[model samples]
Target chain A: MEHILTAFGDILFHPTVLLFLVFGVVVGLIVGALPGLNDTITLAVLIPITFAMDPKYAFMLLVGVYTSACYGGSIPAILLKIPGTASSVVTTLDGYPMTQRGESGKAIGISTTSSVFGGLSSSLVLMFLAPILASYALKFGPPEYFALAILGLSTVAGMSGDNVLKSLIVCVIGLIISTVGMSPQTGYPRYTFGNDYLLEGLPFVPMLIGLFGVTSVFEVAEGLKSRVKDGTFAKMTVPRIGKVLPDLAMVKRLLPTWITSSAIGNLIGVIPGAGMIMAIYMAYDQAIRANKDKKFGTGVPEGIAAPEAANNAVVASSMVPLMSLGVPGNSTSALFLGALMIQGLRPGPSLFQDAPEVAYIIIVGFFVANLIMGPVGILIAKFLSGIIFRIPRETLTAAIALLCVTGAFAVGNSIFNVWIMLIFGILGYVFNKLKLPHSPLILAVILGSMMERGLYQSMVLSKGSLMIFLTRPISLVMLAASVFFAGAPLFSMARNRLKKRAKRGAIS
Target chain B: MKTWKVDIILAAALIVISVVSFSDSRNYPDIASHFPVRLSIVLGILALVLLVKSLIKRREEAMFTLTGEQFRVIVVVVAAVALYTTLLGHLGYLSSSFLLMIGMMTILGFRKKTVMVVTALCTVAVVYAAFNLILGVPLPQDFFMAK
Candidate 1:
């Protein structure tokens, strides 16, 4: 506790770190406000900037970016009817409607409040819980990591949209792509096609940019051609700060949704590959199911609170695996681990013991970033909200295209990476057009490599015995949870079908 | 062609990739081949299932076909990238990148000649500043470096 407080004091007093945090927040907000630009892209671009800075300052910057980007995404979603990131998709349902009604200000305000609240609540949890969780996570062996990977892959089934089979296929394809490098166990190359670049395997950031950014750009272009010119954008009013805060009744209504969704988010986030998007969607679904009187997708406070709280909560909990076991839960956290590596810090049990101050600083920094996000979000909301809406479609598309191209190229400084990005872009477009979920594909890709590595290591360690996963209590519990979660949709679908048939019989 | 045709084409491509990947796995030892071989097999199975489903269903839906103009734009962009890659070793990063950006902007229908020139120049300058000055990462200088 003393160490944590001292770390906090140091971070507060450090001018350089504070400046980087503010700069990161500003950059993150701008990137997140821009339609088609996401937190991943922002982080990727900022990575170049971080190459020269100290790891502690660099990570502080990234933490700021990560926290604020979530808040920034809601701005465009509220104003432009376009989600800045996949996790913000639910925000658009009510956010856009509010914009159309000329209540853009009110919508932005509520979004800002909820976003800050969600982020702060999660950061607090992270500050208190991460150290304790790290202690437990230190006990995990290869078997536990392998089980966790399987649990991560299981999320693909849950996030497969409507078609579980198609999602599985995409997941399989992703797993294949993940295997396209040198084998960890034997040091033998697999599927490298004699290319030197392939020996290092497919880079994740470039793949993500192609999958999310470039593909979305194509879709945006398509939509631009058909979209009606609604001059309703010009006259949109920004709501005052007072009007945006939820009334007493609204707060009461949203409290359960917020708490429940945050809990769900934290739980799911502890499991690898269950990302913020899934957390947000599941929270939204739960909130809607629970609300009997209020119709969701109608600017209801609970609808906003549920997803916002859930996504943000997942942000902190996603760090549990990364900090404890040196296994990243999601892409952002994976990048965070990479940043730690670049700083010569190996994230494991030893990190807490060796550099308790650094660990505590990062945990406390989350709390500070969250607190800063609220006021920053409100101050910038009115100015940025209007300006972003006014950005010409042509310029927006071109700038994004350029960013995607350069960002993808910069990932590894290889033209082959550029080609890969373009290929994934087309693949992403095809998946989007076909109503196939890309989340499962991405999650599979990320987890697939780790799963293979973990499984092989565990097998070698245990002398080919498959019983290791069952023998480890932590691994066993995670695997059981994965099975239960995977089975949930089937039961729900069955019940829904049965209800529909009964309704039809009653009508007859 | 219908959406199912696209699905069939994708399935066929998957099968080919999987087969090639499986064959390539032969060089690796048992432990090394384990993951890739398993992945290839799973991919093959999935592709086969997709092929069978496509054949059985024969479902037709309006495919989101690209317009000829859109097709032309994409082709030009790809061609520009190819040109950039092919010339990179010989022409160097700065010259090749500038040419690529200009060509892409023109192909994408940015009509103003000045806009194209400005965009190309600014892109190269900014990228150069970022890589060379800021990050201090070396770029391919080709013949100039030897001199």
Candidate 2:
């Protein structure tokens, strides 16, 4: 307790750290409000640059970005029909309608209030939950770790958008890609093909930048022709800005919805691969079920508040698995893991034991970032509305592309990393074309080696007996849960199909 | 091509990749080979399942087909970036990045000559300042700067 309080004090009192945190919030808001940029892409581009700063300051910046970007995504979602981030897709259901009805101010205000409430609520959850999970996870053995890896990999089913088979294939491919470096148990390189660079495995940070940042640039380029055709840049209009805060009565009415949706968001956030999109959708669904009087999709405050709160709630809670189990809950948290690795701070229980200050600072950073995200995000949205839209799309695209290259190169001072970024960028573009989910590939890359190491180590420990995994209680339970999660999507699909067939038969 | 056709091609390609990967992993010791060996089999099986599903279902919707302009833009962007990366070694970070930004702005259809030039230069300068000067990353130097 004393150590945590001291860490918090140090983070809050330190001028430079506080400045970076504020700077990150401001940057996060601006970038998030933009159409193409999101928390993942921005973090991917920023993580390499953070290598120069102290880990504490670096995390302050990143945590600030992570917390605010989710909220910032709601800005464009409310003002324009375009969702700034994928997580804000549901926000557009009601947000844009509010804009058309001249309630844009009220909508933005509700979004801001709900986002702050959600973020702070989940930060508390993350603060309390992560440390306890980490301590409990301290007792995990090789089998348990392998089971945990399985549990992580099982999330591909959830992340798979429409096609479970495609997601599985991508996950397998990612696992195979992860095998490119040396075998952990034996020092023998597996798939290096005599390349020395492959001995260190794939460059993680560059790959992330490629997968997120470069891919986004390619997507932006692809969308340019349509934007031009639709006069997106030619004749953009700025809507009127009015009152920015929700009334006390409105806040009281939204209090239950905020609490319910935030709880849903936190729950989904902690579950690996069930990311912000699911949180928002689930929250929106819950709102629809709860409010029969309110017509959703026609600009209801509950509608905007539900998804806004839920998405922001996801920002902090997603870090729970990363902080506790060293398994990133989603793509954004995976990037955070990459950042931590770059700073030479391995996550999990040992981090708390070895460097409690850094751990606590990160936790406290989330709290502080969330507390300030409300004001900072609102200020940027209120004041910079004109400027945000005025920045030429071409410039943003070029800048992002350049940043991707610079970030990739900066990681190792090698042009080879840049090439890796390009390759993955192209691959990412291809994956998007094929409707394959990037999250499965990312999760696979991060967890693949861990799984292999655990499998082999447990084999050695038990004299090559596979029963070792089944014998351990925690491992057995985890493996069971993994199987259940992995199969759930397929089972649900089959059930839906059967119901459809039955309905057709009855109709006929 | 139809989406099913694309899926079929993708499935076949994946199967081939798994086969090659499996064959490549065959020479490694058991400890080194087990994971990939198993993973390759799983990938092959998954691909085969996809192939079968695509063949059976024959979903006829178009895949994410790109329009000509969009395709042209994407191709130019990729080619330009590839060129930019290649140039980064010889031309240095600042020059290569500046050229890349200009090319990107042009390809993205920014017609304002002055804005494009200024934006490109400013972006490169900011990158160079942040990465090379402030962060001390050893960004590639031009011949003159190197001297």
Candidate 3:
């Protein structure tokens, strides 16, 4: 506790950290408010630049971006009826209607206030919970780690929404991609095909930039001709924003909702692959049940508050798995995991004891970022309305493409990485066109090497005994959880089908 | 075309790839082949499941189709990116990037010549300064500099 407080003060007084934090917030707001850009792409593009900075400062920037982007997404959802980020899709249900009633400012205010409440609450939770979890995870062995990775994989595959088979296939592909370089257990290369560059496997940063950045550019290009021909760009006009602060009574009415939604969001965030979309929807459902007197999709304050609070809560708490167990909870946190590895910081139980200064700075940095995001995000929402839409889509698309190319090349000074980025970008674009989920692929790539290494090490420890995993208590529990997660959706689907058949029989 | 048809095609392709991968993994040493062989088998099985599901449970939902104009725009963007990457090696980062930017904007229907030229130039300048001067990261050398 004392060390955490000291680290908190260290970041607070440090000019460079404070400057980068504020810069990250402002950048996150602009990017988040842009429809195609999100925190993941921004983090992917910026991670290369951070290779030149201190790890602590680099993470402060990332934490600030992660904290604010979730709130920034609500801006367009309120005014333009287009969600800047997918998580804010729920905000549009009531936000656009509020705009129709000339209450855009109040809607923005409620969103900002609720988002800050959720962010701060989750930051407190993260601050307290992550360290304890990390300390506990220090007891885990290779078998346990392997089972934890399997659990992560199964949870993501299970919760992937109506396409578990497709998700599992992509995950397998990603794992295969991860195996391209030299084997961890043996020095022999698996699939390098004689290229020296392939011996290093695919470069992580370039692959990410391609997936998040270049793919976005391709998507924007796909929409380009239609948006131009239909005059959608010309038809867009900035909506008027009224007063940007909620009154005391309005805050009081929203207090219980803020607490409930934030708690829900944080819990969902901690679960691997559950994601912000689920968090927001679950919270919105809860808000509807609680506020029966107020109609939900009719511009109610509770409507915007529920999703805004919930998503921001998810932003802070999603880092829990990454910080504690070295498993990423979602794609964005997976990027953070990549960033940590780039900084030569292995994220796990030992991270706290090994590098308390860096670890605590990130945990405490989330608290300060939320404090800064409230006012700064509100101010940006008020003033940047007209400016945001004025930038032409063509220019934005071009700029993103160039950034993707340049950022990919900056990592290793190799043109090969640029090609990798292009390949993944095209792959990602095709995945989107096919409606395949990208989360499973991304998580699988990040976790694959860890899983394989743990598996091999466990085998070595147990002298090729297949029962070693089941014999260990921790590994057994984790494997059982993985089995449950992997099977739960299928079980539910079967049950629902049976119930439907029973109902049909009753009707007959 | 129906989405189920597309899924069938995708699943078939994935099954072939996984089979080939599994066959390739067989040539490797036991220690190196262990994980990949199992992973490929899993992938093959999953692909088989998807194929069966799509075949048996066809749906009427339309596949994601692009309009003519949208397809043209995407093709141009892709071609332009391919051209830009090739040019990056020959013409260097600054010159090739300027061309790429101008080409992308024009292809995307930006008609303001002065603004387009200025934006391209400004983008090159900023990228050079940020990546080279400020961050000390190297960009591809200019053709003249290489000589």
Candidate 4:
């Protein structure tokens, strides 16, 4: 704790780190305020720019963007009817109705306060929980790690969107791709095909940029053309606010909803693959039920409070699994895992011990970010609410295309990486067309070597006994959880079928 | 049924990849080959299972088909990017990126000549400055250096 505090004190005062944090918050706000672009695009496009920085600053920037984007997204949700990110969709229900009722200023006020409360509460949760989880995980052996990897991989089925089977196939493909470099035990090359670049397996950052950055460019282009055809792309105007800071009485009225939603958000964030959408929806549903007159979806201030707080809370808590277990709970966290990897900072059990400063910065920076986000949001809400129009579509497209290419090329200064990125971009486009979520594949790629290392090591440690996995208690429990979670949807489907049959029989 | 065709083809391709990967792994030392070979087998089985499931359900949706104009734009993007990659060594980062963006913007119908040129050039210059000047990443300088 002393070490954490010392590191926190050091980073808190550093001008450069503070600057990066503020820069990230500003970018996060604008990107999240924009109707279509969000922090995912921001993180993906800006990764190359972060390559030169210290790991701590890189995270301060990315985490700043990650947290503030959730808040910035609500600005548009309240002022415009469009939710900037998918997580903010629920915010639009009450937020736009409030705008309709000429209470945009109050709506923005509740959103900023609720978001800050949720963000800070979850940062506290992250601060205390992630370290404890990492320490306990440090006790795990190779078998336990292997079981944990399987458990993480099992959650990919959930990240698969609606096509679990297709996602599983993509996940397996990533696993196979991870095998391309050298065999860890024997030092023999496996799938290099005589190419020198394949020795390090696939280049991680380029693959990430290709999968994320370029794929978004294609989608943007597609949407742009469609808008041009329909003539429906109207320029939006920025909103004005009188005062956005909520009073003590309003905060008191909102306290219970804020606390409940934050807890729900934190819980969902910890559960791998449950995601922000579920957290926001659950909180929104609970808030509706809590109202005496059920004024939700009809311009209630509490309605904006529930989803806004919950989604912002999710921003920090989702990092809990990623920070401690080295497994991301959702696609957004998966991007952070990519950032961590690209920074050459290995996440998980030893992360806190290996680099106490980095761990402290992530937690402490998150807390500070929530503090800074409140005022920054209030100051910028009126100025930034309808920023979606000011950004030109063509320039954004061309610039992102340039970013994606150069970012891929800058890694190891290889044109082959550019090729790899383009190939992955094409594959990513196809994946999007097929409705396959790329998060599982990205998670699999990141975790593939870890799983393999654990599996092989456990095998060696057990004298070639496959039963080593089942025999150990931690591994056994993890294996059981993997099975239960992975098989959950199928189990529910079967139960639903039986219930439907019973109802049909009763009606007949 | 038409949409299911793509799924079936995808499954078949997975099976093929599994076979190739397994056979290739056989050439590795036994200690290293175990996981890849085993994982390949599991993957192949899953692909087979997916194929069977799709067949049983027999539900079909339309496959994605791009319009001709959209197809042209996509090809132009891929071609421009590929050309940029090809030229990056000799033409240099600034020159090639400028070329690629100009070509793509033109194809995408950015009609104003001066505006497109200025915007494309500024984009490259600012990006080049950030990466090269600030980040200290040395971009390819084939155009400036006398080879």
Candidate 5:
């Protein structure tokens, strides 16, 4: 505790850290405000910038971006019907409706307040929980770690959302993509296509930029041709700071939702493959189900609070895996891990003892980032909302394309990477056009490599017995949950059909 | 013409990819082939499912079709990237990057000569200053390295 306080004081006093935090917030806001720009892409692009800074400051920048981007996404979602990021998709339900009702100010105000609350609460939890979890995680061996990885894979079934078959297909594809690089256990190349550049495998950052950024540009360009011409800009009026406080009734209503969602978020976050978006959506679903009388998606504060809290909570808890086990739970966290590696710091159980001050600084930085997001979000909301909407669509598309191309090339200074980006961009576009969910594909891509690595390692350890997964307690539990997740939807559909048939028979 | 056609195409692509991947996996030892073989099997199964489903449900849903203008815009952007790749080794990172940005901006209908030149110069200067000078990361040198 004393060390933590000292670390907090150090971070507070460090001029470099403060500057990085401010820079991160600004960059995060820009990325989050722009449609199709996401936290992962922002982190990936800013990675090259971090090579010059101290690792502590570099991580501070990433933490700030992660927190602020969540808040920044709400700006566009409130002002425009379009969600700036996937997590903000639900925010659009009431956010845009509030805008259309000429209360964009109130909506943005509430969103800012709720986002800060969620972020701060989660950050506090992260600061306290990470070290404890790391200590416990130290006890894990190869078998335990393998079981945990399988547990994480099981979440893919739940995340697939009404499409088990498609999700499984996506998971398989992701595994394939992950195997493209050299086999880690053995030094043999797997799918290098006879090119020396391919020996290093597909770069994560370029592929991510292509999937999220470049594909987004094409989608936006398609939308631009027949653009919705609603020129009504709401008069910007921020609610007084005092007015942003939660009332007794509001607090009482939101407390359960916040607690429940945050817990769910943290649990899902610790498991790789189930990202914040999934955590948020699952929490939202649970909240709605539990509070059946309350009409969600109708500007209810609880509705907003649940997902906001859950997503932000996941942001911190997602670090649990990365810090404890050296496995990144999501793309943004993966980038953070990359930054840590670049700084000559390896993340695993020993990090807590070996570098307690750095860990403390990161935890403290998360808190500071959450605190900064509220005021910055409110200050920039009105100015940015209008400016972003008015930016010529053609120019935005062109800039995005340019950024994507440059970013792809810069990943490894390989032109081949640029080609990969284009290939993925086209795949993304086609998937979008076909109304197929790209999240599963993206998630599959991210997890695919890890899954292959884990499965191979486990098989080697178990001497080729596929029953190893079932024999392990943790893996068995996770597999059981996956079965439940997969079966529950089918059961629900069947039940609904039977009810409809019964009603029709009664009428006859 | 139908949803089945799209499904067939995707399925065929998946099949080809799986087959190629399986044959390729044979080169690696058994330890390495384990994961790829499993993945190929999964891919083959998914392709079969998709093909069957597409055949079963032949009706097409209304889809968003891109206009010629939009297609042209995308084509120009793609071409700009291709041009950048072709020229980067020869012209170097800074010069090639500048040309790519200017070419893309122009292709996207930014006709102001001053704006184009300014945007090009500023982008190159900033990117160069940030990546090269501040970060100490080396950029592609092209003929400049020889000099």
Candidate 6:
């Protein structure tokens, strides 16, 4: 604990790290305020730039972006009735109504307050729980780790979006891609297609930029003519935002709601692939059930508070799994994992001990970021909303296009990554158009290597015994849990279908 | 035109890819082939299920036909990006980027010439400065500089 605190002093006192954190907070707000951009794209674009800096400050900048993006999303949600980020969708339920009632300033206040509270509390949760979780995970054997990877893979059911089978297919495709590099055990090339570059496998950063950033540009391109013709472009009208912080009385009044939502959000964030959108929905649902304000979505502060708090809580706790088990909890956490690897820090149990300073800095930086997001968010609320919305989509789209190409090439200074990125970007765009979820695919790419490592090691240990997974208690329990997660959704779907048929028969 | 038809096509493609992958993995050494072989099998099964599911359900999702303008905009953007990639090492970062941004912005319906130029120039400059000076990362050299 003392060492962690001392590391905090070391990082916080650094001139460059402090400046980058502040820069990240401001940039995060603007990025999250604009409808065209969000956390994923911003992080994807910025990862290349971070490669030039000290790893600690690099991480601090990215963490700063992660912490504040969730809060900045609420600005547009309250004002324009358009969610700047997907998680802010729930915030729109009450936020826009609050604006209609001339309480836009109040709505922003509650959102900012709840976001800070959730962020700070969850960062603390990360600081304390990461050590405990890492120690527990350290005891996991090869079989247990394999089963845990399966458990992570099982999240495809929750994240698959309307079509579970399609998601599974895409995820398997990612696993296939992950197989392109040399085998970890034998060092034999598998799917390199005779290319020397394939020996090291697909580059992670380029793949991410393709999937998140460049694909977004393509999708935005498809809508360009429509946006132009319809004149339905984003407006620059800044909404009324006065106080930086919510009233003390209001905070006290909604304290229980905030606590409940934050706890629920943090729990959701801890689970691999239970994303922020789900947390918002779950927290919003709970708040609806428990709220005394009867007005509900008609613009109660609790409605905005619940989802904002929950979503911000997700930002930090999502890092928990990535920090502890090295298994990213969701797509954003997967990016954070990539960032850590880029910084020469492996994100598993050894990371906590091997680089205590780096780990502590990230955790501590997350806390300070939230402290900065509130005051900075309030100060710039008017300025950002007014300017960001007015930035033409054409300009933004073109910039993204150029940045994607440059960012992909920045790493390894290889133009080959540019070509690979183009392919993935097209794949992403097509996948989006087809309504197939790629989160599972991205998760599979990251976890596929880990899964194969564990499976192979366990096989070597057991001498080809398939029972290794079932024989060990920890592995057996994890396998059972994976089975439960995989089956429960399908079982419930079947049960619901049967109930619907029975109800129709009764009516007939 | 139905989305289920698209699903069938995609599922079949997946199966074909899995077949190729499975065949390829079979050529790898035993120790290296373990994961890919099993994964290929899983892929085949998943693709087959997707095909069968689409056939059974046969849901007709509305086909969104793009306008000529929209199609042109997309084509222009894609072509611009491909051209940018090809020319990066030749024309250099700033020179090629300026052309790509201006061309893309025009195609995307940014009609204000002065505003477009300023925005495009500023973007290229800032991105160059950030990536080059601050980060000390190298961009593609100009053809003049290269020679």
Question: Who wins the TM-score comparison?
Answer: 1
Q: Which candidate number has the best DockQ?
A: 2
Q: What is the C-alpha local distance difference test score of candidate 6? A: 0.78
lDDT of 4: 0.76
Residue-wise lDDT of candidate 6 within B1-147, one digit each (tens)? 578898898889989999999999988898789889999999999989989988998989843456787667767777778888898878898999999899888877788999988998999997777666644567888777675
Candidate 3 CA-lDDT value: 0.81
lDDT of 1 by residue, A139-226 (tens): 6677777777687666555444346767887888788888778877767777787888888788766676677666756665554433
CA lDDT, candidate 1, residue A177: 83
- Which tens-of-lDDT digit does each residue in A85-146 have in candidate 3? 66786787789789768788888899999999999988988889875643444456788778
Q: Tell me the spans in candidate 4 whose CA falls farther than 4 Å from its real position.
A: A1-134, A223-366, A373-388, A499-508, B145-147
Q: Model 1 off-target regions past 4 Å?
A: A1-24, A27-115, A220-363, A377-388, A494-508, B84-105, B114-147
lDDT of 2 at A157: 73
The sequence of per-residue lDDT tens digits that candidate 5 reaches over residues B1-95 is 35568667878888898889888987789777888887898799898998898788785863456667777666766667777777877888877
Q: Is candidate 4 or candidate 6 better by DockQ?
A: 6
Tell me the whole-model lDDT of each prediction, alpha carbons only: 0.70, 0.81, 0.81, 0.76, 0.69, 0.78
Write one digit per residue (lDDT tens) for candidate 5, span A1-508. Answer: 8877987787678888887887788778766765445688778778888888877888889888987887777776676544556666556656766665666666776677667767776677676776565455444444455554454455555444445566667667777887887887786888987777767677755665566566666666555533423322122343222244466776787788878877877776676655666566666656665675666556666666766777777777778778777887778889888888777788866777888777777778888888877777777886655554454555545655655665566556667777887777777677766545554564455556556666777777789887877887766776676566556656766787799999999999
Candidate with the larger lDDT of 2 and 5: 2
Model 1 chain A: weakest 10-residue lDDT segment is A225-234
lDDT of 6 by residue, A97-120 (tens): 887676777888889889988888
DockQ, per model, reads: 0.27, 0.57, 0.55, 0.36, 0.33, 0.51
DockQ of 3: 0.55
- Model 3 reproduces a share of the real contacts of 0.76
